[model samples]
Target chain A: MSEPIVVIRGVEKWFGGLRALGPVDVDLKPGERLGLIGPNGSGKTTLINCLSGLFVPDKGTIVYDGRDITREPAFRRARMGIARSFQIPRPFTGMTVLENLLVPMDYLGSHERSELERADEVLASVGLAARRDAPAESLSQLELRKLELARALVTEPKVLVADEAMAGLSENEIDDVLALLMRLNDTGVAIIMIEHIMHAVMRFSQRMICLETGRIIAMGTPQDVAQDRQVQKVYFGERAGA
Target chain B: MRTLPFLVIAALILVGGLFLPQFVGNPYYFFAGYVVLQYVVIATGWNILGGYAGYINFGTSAFFGAGVYVAAFLIKAFGAPLPVQILAAGVVGMLLGVATGYLTLRIQGVYFSIATVALVVVLETLIHNIDYLGGASGMQTIAPPAPAWFGGQTQYVFCAMLVLAVVAVVAARFIERSWIGRSLRAIKASEPAAEACGVPTLSMKLVACAISGAIIAIAGAPYAYYASHVDPLSAFSLTIGLNALAMPLIGGTRSWIGPVIGALLLASVQQIATVTISSEFNILAVGIVLIAFVVLAPEGILGLIADLKEKLRRRGARP
Candidate 1:
């Protein structure tokens, strides 16, 4: 493939003296579907935080789109086309659903179409056209997830970091989000999906990485990593004495 | 509403307000009206940061008292006119606001509120020690002659306060309608989410704090002339802070109209209470009404009206 769109190297993060994440490395290729799976406290979210400019790594560098972004602010990274969805849906309350999409559009004012047209297009793509005018507080759980994704997609980011975007969603809802991500990737948008749902991530990710306690335990094609001994142990609790 | 139409309506209201002294000849009317309009400016200013940006500022007295003293200083030092005093006070208040926001905005929620209260204490102590601007004792201010049209000092200051009220309300409306308002609402909803969406949350907050401080200071600028005396105790009185917060909550925090409705209602009630009952009942009255609104219609009058309208619309649609 062409040069990786994102290159993360030797990133480390510590909350006080406790090393919560990193001393790890990662690289994301253009239009690639990268799945990151780990158990609770496994530093998946921590890594995403470091990558998205929320928490600058105590050590190491994050180069994005051919520039070093390790010290960049979160908003600056977002403007440079790094977008993310929160694990919990954070709809700008008091605004309507369509207006929620318009929030990001106000900042990234480089879109070809007007904000209204772009917002409408995003809402329709996420299957929320009918609920466009509804207040954000009135959305159901599944709809809120769609809104989270729609907001991330609205910026037209080259890389979308979806942190637990499908968590707590039903089986069919998972498939719905998977299809949305697939369709988005088809349009040349790379996605890094941090998910706890096993089967869904396995299906969506072309390549996968399994993290355990801030360290990468396995990385390769989905089948290879799923069957890797360490990943299996981490997922299934030592697999009945091997 | 569009910008031009909004400004035109604001001008019309201001012109109509200037005629109030003509209809009511009593000096007491202008006195009470001035206090009420002062609350209008303070509440609207406080709402820009407190209601829209979701940062509770418990230090209204800090900005207000600073404005009062700034005006007093300008008058005593340079024999400055009202407009110059107002302009100087606004600049000082805005600087204080940015300084406060820069130092404390990283700490969210109650911590931010607590830091603001500490700011009031710090500024009050500093002013108490400064001898030039009256110190612990008070300073008296004599007003310049009123304009030929206004006919009296109280009436003149009342019209000046009315103009500031219009300016404050119009500025608040402009903020509530613009992209800054949208970003502030987003920040209020979730700061991290707003940041992730490419909104500079801290800078947006600083802008809100600056504008809020300037308007609030402008309200306090004419006060030294109105009261004819400025003292640390009364200038930095806790009542102003409480009333500023209460008015916005009573009216609703969602839009510009909420604080205006709230300030008018609550300030009018307090005025009536001070006159009919006693000066002691003023705080008691605000306390009771605030508790009632907080427990019952927490969204203030606007939210209540919107809910009522929604219920009525739903009913009408059903049959």
Candidate 2:
């Protein structure tokens, strides 16, 4: 592959005395679809948090587009085109859906286009055009997830770290979101998807990384990582110790 | 409303208000109007941070007291005029705001509020010890001669306050309708989400704190001249902080008009209560009205009005 868009080296995070994540390394190429899968408490969110500039790594450096961004604040990182969706929907309260999109557009978007048109386009792309004027608090589960994705997409980010964007979504809703992500990937934006759903991620990702207790247990193509002994053991509990 | 038309209307109304002392023979009206207008400025300033950004500032007295002292010092040392004192107070209050925000904003919620309260106590004690600013005792300040057209010091000061109120309201309104206002709302709603959207939450909060402090201190700058005395007990009065918070809540915290309405309604009630009944009833009135509004109309009069309008519209549509 050509020069990677993001290079993370030896990133580690500690909460008090407990080590939450890493000594992990990851490289994401331009327009790449990377799947990050792990069970609960496996530090998937923690790793993404570090990558998105929420937590400064206790050790290691992150270089984004060849600039050292390990110590950058979250907003600066976002302005630098790295955007993330929260695991939980965090729609700005007391605002309309269109106003919600206007916020990021106001702060980080290109001023070449009218902000309303850009916001409306993103809303339509996510199938939320009908609900554009609706209050964020009034959205349903699927709509909230779509809003989360739409918000991330509104930034027109180079790297979109979607943390459980498909959780609590219906099966049909899952395919809809999956198609949205695929379409976005086709537009030359790299995506790091953190999901608990196996088949959906396996289908979306060209490469996969399985994390267990903050360390990578497997990294390969979908079929290869799925059948890996270590990944299978982590998923199925080693078949009762053989 | 568009910026130009809103400004034009506000200017006309404020200029008309400046002529009020000419019509009313009673000097008490100007005296009372000064206090109400001062509250308008304070409540407007308070809402910029408290209502919009959701940062409760118990240090209203701290900034106000600082302005009172700053103006007193200028008056005593340089015999500076009201405008100069106000300008100086704004600068000092802004610095204090930046310092306080830097120190306390890292701690969220009630912890931040407690720190602001602590700031009040700390500043109060520091002011009490400073002999130059009259220490535990108070200093009397004499006002410069009022202009001929204004008639008296009270009327002139009332005009000055009316101007400041307009400025404060316009500033608050501008912030509400601007990008900064949207960013502050985002910070209030969710800091992490705002930051992820490239809002720079900490810096935006500091901006709110600075502007809020400067405007509040501007309200206080003329107080020494108005009251004719600056003392720790009165300058750092508990009532100022209470009313600063209560006025915004009673008006509506969501928009610029809310605080203005709140200040006008609450301050007028207190003034009338002081006139008709015992002066002690001022706080009592505030307490009763505040509790009623909190219970029955938690969103304040503006919210109530909006709900009423919505219901009326729905009814009309049904017909």
Candidate 3:
């Protein structure tokens, strides 16, 4: 296999006296669908934040595309083709849907196509063409999630970290988003889906890792990880009881 | 190419202003016109950072006062021309803006605003201690004689302010339509999201600050020449800061025209109130209008107009 597109080695993070994530290592390959699963406060978001350059690891190096980018700023990482959607959708308020996509496109200075055409295309791809001129504040919950995905897609990113992209979504809506992400993956984009929904993540990931107390308890194919005793006891067992 | 219309409007306004002194015999009209135009610059400047980026700066007077002092120093030291004084003031204002934005913007939101307010106090104290620029007292300025083409000094200053107002509006409009404006709006909506989307939020904010600071200070440079006096109290008056904030909020913060409209309406009303009711009543009236706008129409007059149009369209469609 080719060298991994992203290599995280010995990455750890601490918030004050509390250790939130790490002493963990992971690798993502090109065009891979990686599911990152963890319980509440189990460091899934923390790990993604580290990967996306929101927080520098207290220790360890994050090499992306063969270069150490552990110290890079979030914006620089974004321009270097690392894009993410917030767990909570943040639509640029007071702006039209088309304008929201235009923001990132304009900043990245990509003009392969006219901005208006590109914006229209993205909006269409996300099934939001009908609402292109609508104010972002006027979007439905499902539409907002689609917008979040579209905003990340506008950069033509190599790695897309979708943080809880399906949380609070109905089962059908989850499937809709899953299908959209799968379609994106078919175009050769690597996606790191950080999710709490087990069935969806299990169905989506070719490889999955379960995080607990800031450490990876299981990492393997979806079936193997699901069948792992520790993953069941620490993740599924608790959910089954609840 | 898109700016052609704005340029044309600016030229037309300039031509119209040049012919103003020919008709208006009263020097008071020019004086009032200068004050209104000055606020036009201030409001437009404030909106660049405050409206576009959602960074509320309470230190408007600090930049304004810095320009006044810069002009005072230039007049005292080298007897610089009005253009030179204005240019120097712009540089100083831009520097202060960049410095302050660099130091405080990292804190974010209300804390950033408080830091800006503190900046005013620090600069005001610094000016108060400087003996050369008339420390506790103020400096008296005798402006150079007006050029032969302009009938008088007031008309010249009025024309100067008109030019500044035009320039400020044009700059604001350009920014609103540019990539910088879109990035600022994104930053305003969500800084983290904007960063993740590839906007250098801090750098864009600093640029906004520098441009805003320079324009506001440019407004103050002419003030020193117009009033023919430089006092720290009047220069850094809370009213100027309040007006700077209020005008943009009242007119609408979405586009460049909002602040211009707000400043024109509010400044004109204040001018009338000062003459008819009393100077004290002028402040009270502004306070009342601002409160009413904030409560009844947070989007300001432009927003109110848009809402009304939407309502009219809906009604027409129903019929």
Q: Which of 1 and 3 is the better model by DockQ?
A: 1
How far does residue B173 in candidate 1 sit from its true spot (Å)? 0.8
Q: Which residue pairs in candidate 3 collide?
A: none
Best by DockQ: 1
Model 1: lDDT to the true structure: 0.92
For model 1, residues B1-319, the per-residue Cα lDDT tens digits are: 5789878999998999898878878888899999999999999999999999999999999999999999888878877889998999999989988999999999999999999999889988998899887789988877566777887889989999999999999989989977899999999999999999999999999999999999888889999889988999988989999999999999999999999999999999999989899988989888999999999999999989989999999999996
> Candidate 2, what DockQ?
0.80
**Cα lDDT tens digits for candidate 1, A36-93:** 9988999999999998888989999999999999999999999899999999999999
Model 2 agreement with the true structure over A55-166: per-residue lDDT tens digits: 8999999999999999999999998899899999999887889888888888765555587888889999999999999989899989998998898898889999999999
Residue A90, model 3: Cα distance from true site in angstroms? 0.8
Model 1 misses residue B250 by how many Å? 0.8
Each model's TM-score? Answer: 0.98, 0.96, 0.97
Winner of 1 and 2 under lDDT: 1
Give residue A207's error in model 3 in angstroms.
0.9
Candidate 3, B1-319: lDDT as tens digits: 3578878988899889988988888989998889999999999999999999999989999999999889888888888889999999999999999999999989999999999899889988998999998996888887677776767889888988898899899889999988889999999999999999989898999999999999989999987788888988999989989999999999999999999999999999998888888888878888999999999999999999999999999999995
Candidates in descending DockQ order: 1, 3, 2
- Which residue runs does candidate 1 get wrong by more than 4 Å? A110-113, A238-242, B1-8
lDDT of 2 at B123: 88
